[model samples]
Each structure stands twice: as structure tokens, then as C-alpha cells.
Target: MDLRQLQYLVAVAEEGSVRRAARRLYMAQPPLSQALLRLERDLGVELFTRTSRGVILTDAGRELVGRARDILHQVEDARSAVQATAPDDSATLRIGAVAGPLSAGELTRPILEAFRALHPDVTVRLRDTSFADQVDLVASGVIDVALVRCPVVHDDVDVIPIAAEPRALFVRSTHELASEQTLSVDDVIEYPMLGLDAPEWFSSFWQLDPERGHSLVDTQLPPVSTVQGIQLALAAAPLVVTGCATMARFAPSPLIRAIELPDASPSIIGVAYRRGDTRPVVRSFLEAAASAAAENIALLPNATSSV
Candidate 1:
């Protein structure tokens, strides 16, 4: 289907109602509904199941929705890059690395400084964003590349997984569980949980089960968006925060402890770039990353952060 049709499909899927999607797209409801029907007919599959509550994506719709987001994000990036870049534009690479293990430790730290040393002439712009969600930043060309916590999830971006480290539970050192080097998910979940914003598949990374779905919440915890925020949170409340190896680095203070989760899903730390991107800088960054992971060499210079 054409981009217009794909856009309409995504809108309906996201908003869950034709009328709402129409409002979002600034279009009439009838045409949006007609467009949805046309798309389903052309694809030869039912995309959504209508119910009293709203619309739910069928299995096929769920699949197509991800594909649609990828296509649209790529198109938007292409348009932005072309329009924003002039022939004489300065050589700059915008990179986003989330705040945590992805940016703090062995793999990404060396690679960041290494990439800069290798391409000294290029201006590198760095931003610290929330975990995993940086895939959207890369696909949209808001940044040229990213180092982020895993399950990149978006098909339009490519991830080079550097390390598979177990998730950890962070708590105040004074907390009872702090002395334990490791803890079970059930034990960790019993405390008030501080959650990070991540994809649905990432709920487990937060020590939350899909079926359990934040059942451990004593009070709905405020959103902790960064490592600094999590640190601030520890001083304020007895909340259990879950993260990967980077969390360990943040735990040197007497205020916090990093407890291992051997049974938790192995947190995938990686570099992400737009799918099919082959610019020399991007390639160099990837090459550096592969070498870092292969050699397992680490130099602990922290990532440089910019707005």
C-alpha cells in the first residue's frame, strides 16, 4: 500500500478508533475507515478486531504495525536528512546513548572515545536518553547512531549486541536486601518498584512479568527516567530499581547496592544504527564496536554528554 494508506493504518492502530485516528490525522472518519478497509482488502488479511471497548490489532495487524512504523520512520529520516543537510554542512555525527550500563561501562565507553580519536575532524554530538527507546531516535535520524540497552525492537534499526549481562536490582545500602549479592525476582518485586520507561517486551527487564504486570506496585512509583533519577529515588524512598551492569558502576556509594539477578533475562547491551546505513563514520563506529566486544577490552572513560 502507499505511504498515505500506511500512515492511516498506523494511526488507527495507535488510536484504536477510526474517529480518534481521523482526529489525529486531521481527516474525516469515513475516509479513514474506508482507507482501513481498503488496506485490509489489499493485504488479504484482517488487521483489527472491533469490540465494544475499542479496536484491537489482529496478529497480522500487530506485525504490520511494526513494519509500518519502520517504513514511516525511515521515510521521515530521509526527508529530514536531505532537508536539514546542505552540501557544505559541517561533518557532524549526533549520537545518543541512554543513561546506564549502556553508556557507563566497558564496551561503549572505549568505543565512544575511540570513535572520536579515529575521526578527530568530525564533530560528535552526544545525548543521554532513556534505554532501548533510542532506537526510535536513530531510525528518525534525530541521531546518527546510539549505544543503548537492548531488545532494540524496531525493525528499521540494526543492533550490534556487544554484551549479554544479567539484570540487577538496585537498592539503598541500608535496605535489608542490600547485603545479599543476589535476589530472586519474586523477592525483589515485593518492595515498591521504581519503573523505567521501556517497550512492552522490556517489562521483564524491570523485574516485572507480563502476567504479573506491575502487580508489585505498593504505590505507583514515579517514572525514573535516568540513572541520576534512580539515584535520587533511592535517597527518597525504599524502591527497588532494576538495571544491568551499568547499575553496578552507579553503586559505589554507600547509599546504593547492586544485587545480581542470575535468573533474570540477560540484558543485551549494543550499538544501534539506522538499518542499511553505511556512512563511513557509522561503519567505523560499528567496526570499533565489534573489535571491542571481540577483544573484550575495556577502558573506563565515561561517555561524554551533550544536550
Candidate 2:
């Protein structure tokens, strides 16, 4: 009935449990439960069906949840637009980027230069982040935008394709696959891979398979989830997987070589900003990125989302 109730509805729908949603919202369980009850009563519809594991959205709930997100995004846009009636002359855009391509200056440099050329007065700041954390950073407002690899999931962000980066399978030089000049997805999926402790969509993007990813937690394969996991990966690297053809620039030891995945589609490197964020500076940055991309990588646009 109100924005508060809609927010409560979305939180519960997304989390699939009242208790989990309450914890995420930093609120107590009782009030949240009452709010859900009140919302259901007002709508005269059962939004959720409770079960032993958690709450599941009913048909009505499923229909309303998407509209609720759109409404929230529009409300945010109105608020941002009102607040920006008088633009701040000294605005700083904080950009987050994955370490590999960013370090190699393959994905971000031209866009950054183009942005600077267009918005000479604005200040730009950079932070090194991984594709794993890029979306969360933008969604949580930790940064203004992110340079990330595509085949990524962005249910709550807008990703604009800027360039294409080739895909390669990374293996330790001594690994058996290293001798192969070209490989296919079928060739690599059988082996252990460095499980990126990332969203399922992101972790699975490299494989080009909706059902497969390096997320088997019990496997002996080292992960890229933490600093210790990274260390373990360096010591005994597994099949390092695809999409990050420039990873060797940041990683050391055990020696790695990238074998061409001649059949795999190249990943589209893009700039992702929170969806419905239509601020002028954000627009400027996007336009700059598009222009730079057109002149540089000239990649075709293919939009996607996990949800």
C-alpha cells in the first residue's frame, strides 16, 4: 500500500524468508512479520507460502515483486533528479575495476581518457576490484560505476558493452592441457577449476553453460575466494578457467599459460552502473564509454540479466 510495505515485500521476496530479510534490513523479526501480514491483508492476496525451509512467493507475489523493484527505482530516480537541480561543480566519480584488465589497461584506459576529455572538470578516482564484487559495489553505492567482464549477472545494474576481450583457458605450464594450442569448452569442463567465490551466474559465465560452474565447495581444487585461496591457487593451480585472459599480469608463480579457446565467445568488457541511475554525470560517463568503445573495441551489444 505504501513504499515501506513495498520495500518490505521486495526484501521478503528476494530473501525467501522473513527472518533472513529482517536480518538484512537490520530490523527485528516481529515487526517485519506484522508488516507482511498487513501487506497481504491490504492486497487481499496471499503473497507467500510458508514452508519448513523458507517462504516461497505465490503467483501474486511473483508478479508484484518485479513491479515493486521498478517503482523503487523510479522513486530513487526522482529523488536523485530533484537533488541534482544544481549540479556540484566538483563532483568525483569513483570507478571500480577488475584487477586484471584494469592493470593491463585493456578495458578501462580508453574509456577513462574519453570520459576525462568530455568532463574535464570532474575528478575521477579508481579502485581495484574483482568481477565478483563489482556489481555489489555499484548496487550498494560503494562506487559510482564499475568496469567488468560480461556474461555477468546484473539484475539491479545497467551494463553497457564497451569492448570485447578474447577468452582463453589458463593452465599451469606443466599441466597437460598447456600443450594444446586450442581447446573447447568440452575439453576443459572435465577438469577441476579455480572456483571463484562469486555469484553463480558470474562463476559460471566462463564455461558458457547455465548449469556448470567451479562452485563445488568440497573439491580439492583451490579457490579464488580469498587471499589464502589465491595463495593456494598459486602453489598448486588448477585449470584457471576462461574469460580472464590477462590474469597472469596480477598472478605469480607455478607458471601459467593461456591456451586459446578458439570456439568460446569473447567476453564483452563493459561499464556497469546501478540501474535507473540517470544522473547527468553518470550519463556523461556512459556516453563517453560508448563513444570510446565505438572507436576502439567496436563490440556489438548483447544485453543480459540473471533474473
Candidate 3:
């Protein structure tokens, strides 16, 4: 009935028990149960079904939960919007980036510096999430901007190309390709190739296949979930993966080498956001990214061969 009650319902739904939700919400189980009972009575419907496993949402509860989450998010967005328009230093920009190249510290440093210089009051919060999640985050108003690989299929979002960078074969220092300055895709494919676990956007660069026997690598690995994983894989095994030239520039290990993949197309990195956002902070950041992209373009190697 009220935001507090709706909050309680959401908490119970997430925690899956009245006792657990009470613990989380800093209330007694009895009060939380009474609140749920009142909510159900006021709505004239049973929201949850009791079961041995846990509390499960009824059909109406399922629909109500979705709407309640939306309403809460909208309220949060309104609060953020008000804060966003305050003095420059009070503004916040939530940035979503896939955890390399653009998301890494080195590449973001200059842009963040420029952003701070331009709008010193604005606080920038960066999130390193998956490219697929970034799209939805932007569309849902969860993040102000997302810097990610191109070929994003979401039509509800607007994308601005930030840079086109070379795709290189990353390998451990002991790997045969480590000493080489350039590599053909065919040459690197001989070793067990470590690849990004992606469906289309990333897979297309390597010309991967869902159908059996059509992939270049003997094994397909999910994207390195952590930066340490990326470093370890490159140090221990021959990881023939594609990365932005900027990412390789920032990695801690000299053990890993970025060899030019002659047959792989360069990855196009860009900024994505909701189509209707007209905020000045968002506009300023986008401009800074565009400027940085222009200055950095010549740093990438040319890919002469096609995939």
C-alpha cells in the first residue's frame, strides 16, 4: 500500500522468507508478516504461496513485483535527476564498461581527468560489467553511459563510435607467438585458442560458429571474469584472444605480448546511452570520448587481411 510496504514485499520476495527479510530490513518477523498480511488484504489477493522450499510468488505477485521494481527505480531516477542538476560537483555519472580497454584504469584515466577538469563538481562512478548487461543497464537508466564493443544489437539505445582499435593475439611469453610482431589467424589457430565466450558481437570478429567443427580454437573459453584471470591465462597458456591496443598498453605483465592478428578485423569501441538523455554531464563526457578517439586513432595498427 505504501512504499515501505512495497519495500517489505520486495525484500521478502528477494530473500524468500519473512524471517530473512525481517533480518535484512532490521525488523522483527512478526511485524514483517503482519505487513505482508495487510498488503495482501488491501490488494484483495494472495501475493505468495507458502511451500516447504520457500515463499514463491503467485501470478499476481509476479506482475506486482515487476511494477513495484519499476516504480522504485523511477523514484530513484527522479532523485538522481534532481541531484544531477545541482552544482557541478554534486552530479554523478554511472558508467558501464566491459572490463578491459575502455574499462581499464589506463584508458579511462585521461578521459576521467578531462571530465573532471571540464566538470569538477560531477562525480563519476564506473561499473565494469558485461557488454550484454551494459546495453540493458543504459536502456533502463541504471547507467548514464556504457563504453563497449560495437555491433550492439539493441535498437532502443543510441551509440556513438569512440574508437576503432587493432585486435591482437595475446600469448604467454613462452608461447611461440610471443616473440613475433605479427601473426596470421591461421598461424595462431594451431595452438589451443582462448576466446571470449560471446554469442555474436565478439564471436563475429574471430568468425566463430555455433555449429560444430566451424570454430578456429580447439576450445572456447568464457570471457575472463577478472583481470587476474586474463593475466594468468596469458602467463600460463597460449591465449589467442582479441583485445584493444589500449588494453595491452595497460596490462601489468610484460609476459604477455600483443601480436597483430592480420586476419582479424579491428574491434570498434564506443559509448552507449539511452536515446532520450539530454543531460549536460552526459553530453560533456561523450564529447571528451570523441576527442580522445580522434587523437588515439593513429596509434592502432592497420588490419590488412579480412576475417
TM-score of each: 0.64, 0.66, 0.57
Candidate 2 lDDT over 144-255, as tens digits, reads 8887765454445667765565567776778878788888777776665666666655665653433242333325663474323544563475455664444544454456
After best superposition, candidate 2 residue 156: deviation in angstroms? 3.6
Stretches > 4 Å off in candidate 1: 1-90, 100-104, 198-204, 211-215, 297-307
Residues 71-148 of candidate 1 have per-residue lDDT tens digits of 988886886476445454337888888773455366665676777788899898888777546667898878888877
| Local error of candidate 2 at residue 18 (angstroms) | 28
Clashing pairs in 2: none
Quick one: ranking by lDDT, best first? 1, 2, 3
Q: Which residue pairs come into collision in candidate 1?
A: 101-246
lDDT of all the models against the reference? 0.69, 0.67, 0.65
> Largest lDDT belongs to which candidate?
1
| Highest TM-score against the true fold, candidate | 2
| Predicted structure 3: lDDT | 0.65
Candidate 3 lDDT, 23-122, residue by residue in tens:
4543345556778899999999999998877799999999888888887777667655765675653288988877645452244556566777888777
- The 10 consecutive residues of candidate 1 with the worst lDDT sum are 298-307
